[model samples]
Target: MTQFTPDLASRFARIALGHVERRYPFKLDQVLLGPDDRRSPTELHPVFHGSFDWHSCVHGYWLLARIGRRFPDLPEAAEITALFDRKLTPELVAGERAYLDRPLSGGFERPYGWAWLLKLAAELEQRMAPAERAWAEALAPLAQAFADRFRAYLPKATYPVRAGVHSNTAFALRLALDYAEAVKDQDLAALFRHKALAWYGADADCQAWEPGGDDFLSPALIEAALMARALPAGAFVPWLDRFLPRLAAQEPGALFAPATVSDRTDGKIAHLDGVNLSRAWCLREVAAALPVGDARRGVLGKAAETHLAASLPHVASDYMGEHWLASFAALALETA
Candidate 1:
């Protein structure tokens, strides 16, 4: 077992807060500057590439929640959650009927409604004090709102799954499970727990598409393992134990690789490996959650180190001014 030094944790906190400040806009209530800021007309487009457009914002907000929990003294906590409520409240109230058709919405056409929201809320809840819960009363309501939406989607005829990085869904569900368990809402927690177990068992085929060759993809896998472990009886343990070693082995190359490009096909030749620091944090979370004496625990340690080493440069970057990668590295470093 390892604990990240205070200096490392502070660096992560700085980066996380930096990302939130630099990327987020109160007016838009979303992270990142629209393409309009750039001089070139052609440059005016979404900044990331993925199935869901809002994942960056979602990921950012979730990261912020963790930061908020880790450093409750900062006023950014209320500011962050307020921004989250601005963008997310409608969807929660919209229930299952909410569709991604809105040009601005980033989620894919799936039943992700409640699962992800609960995760965000849970992260926020972690930092709450007994006296502060009253001030944060909306947190529980917001979580319930997601539950209503998720339950609405549960009866669907068919659910489409992501082809790569199944961790997207897994983290969302894991967060939901975490939220449920922490909140002592047993029934709500069980719902997500059951669904996570079912998906993990059926997701063998999806694992093939994992960005195992990429460091960024490892975080998603960590999240998947986390959600799987969220179930009782060590449900996700065996497979998670099996998954880390190979991913950890790839760390040396992936870390040395240039930054991960935002758009793989843009032809601009950007490096983006640093953008995936969240994977390290997720890996640590999974490792911490696993039952002790499991063989995979050792592998988790190796994977955790690889992830931290990969993120070292960004954590040390004095000029980047706190981006997503910074906070993620901080959290992962803290967990490590």
Candidate 2:
């Protein structure tokens, strides 16, 4: 599982195709400025109204696009292309972008959904096939909308969110950074880099108090992953050392250990599964950032392997998790 094989990619692709358009049991992140604000998910987001919620739906698309890119000849690729063709047209995507203009929509999905949107945009932007290019072009406006949101929001953010859930600033900025780099938006890239360092540069000796009741992310590992991508190698190692100073000894046993998912039917309880998957992602990112032959590399790599093992099996276990968990699994397995 160190690298995604064709079969693994197809499996992940099939999982995403199962739900990207299954518009039911949706959780709407809406604001009611008036009576008309009570609209259905598809009405609010034509292209991203499936897979449980908007953010999850966006990441679901990311997973499909990623698999399509990495394994173009997989059997599931045709269905993925058809899904993109049907859902990513200008008219549909415009509805998705227009949702942001509502009076009460300023914070529709905030950083979590915002990050996933940009992540989808970035993946599409990298595409080479004709269909993929059109998908990117069709979705460009929506991507820019979120990117604009980031530009306006970051300047006034002032402080970082250290949560392990949707509002986590580290996870948002890390994904947005990829989008920024892909589109060659130096201004946005600079903004992200500056804000990221300003928020996390001095952070040290993180207590690693994590894996909260329903957390789907590792606040500790994600922060380190952001710093790893944000800072230069020369500076990143020192920052990482200070951030997780006891990594060699695995002192913060919480980080090295995977979370226990007692139940997957409950949406919140299901997040622990995501915690394992996302931790594996961040763990791999951080371990890759480490210098060659570093002892911490082995430690982090081992943790990542075990973490993936804990959650990868259940990516399609229950509708509560199946709707979105595959995206995190893709993140964990595809990066390498």
Candidate 3:
């Protein structure tokens, strides 16, 4: 199986630190109410104005925190720490919080960015050095803002978003659950579990017609992984049985195969590489959640290996992919 080595961690850290503050080549997730709102990314976002977009930058910070905790002697640790100290200030966080309060910014990054901010906060909370803890404290209000968004939006969401992209409800919930469990937020955790069951509890026989050419996440597998996290072992096993009855047979052949990336230069096409890495992670999580003697364990395990092999090499090959793919690669190799 692929492992996260110190070398790999250093490499990914360098990639994130290289572009976390690059202002150009950015896609702002904001609404321009007037000429006054035409400010640059750094001025508007204050802290997260890099890695192409808001959510990716948030998770890029998450990758840095995760790797920094695991490999403290990393070459980029000082730089990462310095960046956090400079950027993750109370003033900057207040600016970010204010952005969320804007009338037109209600849907800004919504569940996707919201989830990543909480995940970053969770990482910082778990691995609290004196300096890092200060940064984490500074970021709490922004994290709470997103948490409030989740509490407000989920109940009103009549139908879950089943897309294989950033808007996917399962993907957001999985990450949010990680944050909730990390912080011992029982109310948030219970809310996520309830909503997940309501949205996907009855889902079965997923056709797995996915990889929409510009896709990243595996809708069926991510939902399965989320259910695996939310449900107990006994309940999960039965749920998995009903949801993916043909896993042993690999009926959804697409799930086993790696997506083909014809162009890495194009942003949307580059998403296929993300598909492979994310699918690898979801499959690994699902396989690990299964009973030891389950027949589908071997199937999911092999498919996870296949997908990892397909995308691990291309994580830092191009700017288009490099700006964000390392985070997904890290997620694929991360242990639960």
Candidate 4:
């Protein structure tokens, strides 16, 4: 296997260092931290403020995990670690907690938070500092609580999910894998594995389930591959290979030419419209995890370049501020 070139590695290192140093322990208690705090749902071009939402937080967790992996001297690493710990505080979410419901678009809030927190906690332990074992341990209960509540909540749940909502559930499966691996709970992890597989198998009518329509389906498949790897199953490999390239090939200039929507650069892409930075980053993430090879690296490079060229310039003043754009820029730079 070829080693990662110094240029690419250095770029990754810089982004990781930048992310840990720049991002922070701003606000964890408030469910919705408003756009000013670097968190938001709908982003308006040239405005770029932060708001609190499940998608943004999950994206944060995703970037932080990667940063912790590449950068050794990350300043905000500890603060991020603590922020995750704070998320587990049962004291804040005192009332009834719901699970499994597609709460991303507003059904319930706890599950999405737990999935992301658990994922960030696990990544912190694995790549940040092994010495922070105790800190990571503190968040396990929160993950377990989330899973329990989710199981309790999904008794009569619906399926065939849309892009935004289903992706959150897919994230929950990934978090379940993380929690299971970190806590060494094989049985619990297996249950998550089973659930994810079952969900994927849902009929064509299932909105949450994708039978290879590409775009969003590719990222979801990559995530499922991650879960499968953690749980050790061979089934996910083929689908992953099938979807990665399709997702990677989509470019920007082609879109503004053949478009139904009037202005593609408006920057308020939530669901539909076939293009969003979130889905593109998912491919970047999966490529990062895979063994470094010329083919794989090329795929990542293309994904990074496409996204960076189209999205990076918009980051500084966009409505969602620089958070998501910066995070994805870092990922793209890493692959480049």
TM-score list, all predictions: 0.61, 0.98, 0.98, 0.55
Please give the ranking of all candidate structures by TM-score, highest first, separated by commas.
3, 2, 1, 4
lDDT by residue (230-267, candidate 3, tens digit) is 98658998888889889899978888889999999888
Ranking by lDDT: 3, 2, 1, 4
Q: Model 4, range 241-308, lDDT digits (tens) per residue? A: 44333433432233212112234344343221233344344455555556556365465545544544
Question: lDDT tens string, model 1, 221-293?
Answer: 5445556456556556555545433443443244223244444432122113443455566656676766788
Clashes of each: 11, 0, 0, 16
Query: Candidate 1, residue 233: CA error in Å?
Result: 2.3
Query: Model 2: per-residue lDDT, tens digit, 1-336?
Result: 467789878888887888888889888887777887788888888988888888888999999998888788999988988889998999998888788888778887899989888988999988887867999999999999999999999999999999889999999999999999999999999999999999999998988987899999999999988988999659999998898899999969999889999989989999999999999999889889888999998888889999988988898889999998888988888666
Provide the lDDT at 309 for model 2.
87
Off by more than 4 A, model 1: 1-3, 19-65, 68-116, 127-131, 164-167, 202-209, 212-216, 237-276, 289-295, 315-322
Candidate 1: TM-score?
Answer: 0.61
Query: Residue 195's C-alpha lDDT in candidate 4?
Result: 64
What is the lDDT for 185 in model 3?
95
The lDDT of each candidate is: 0.48, 0.89, 0.90, 0.44
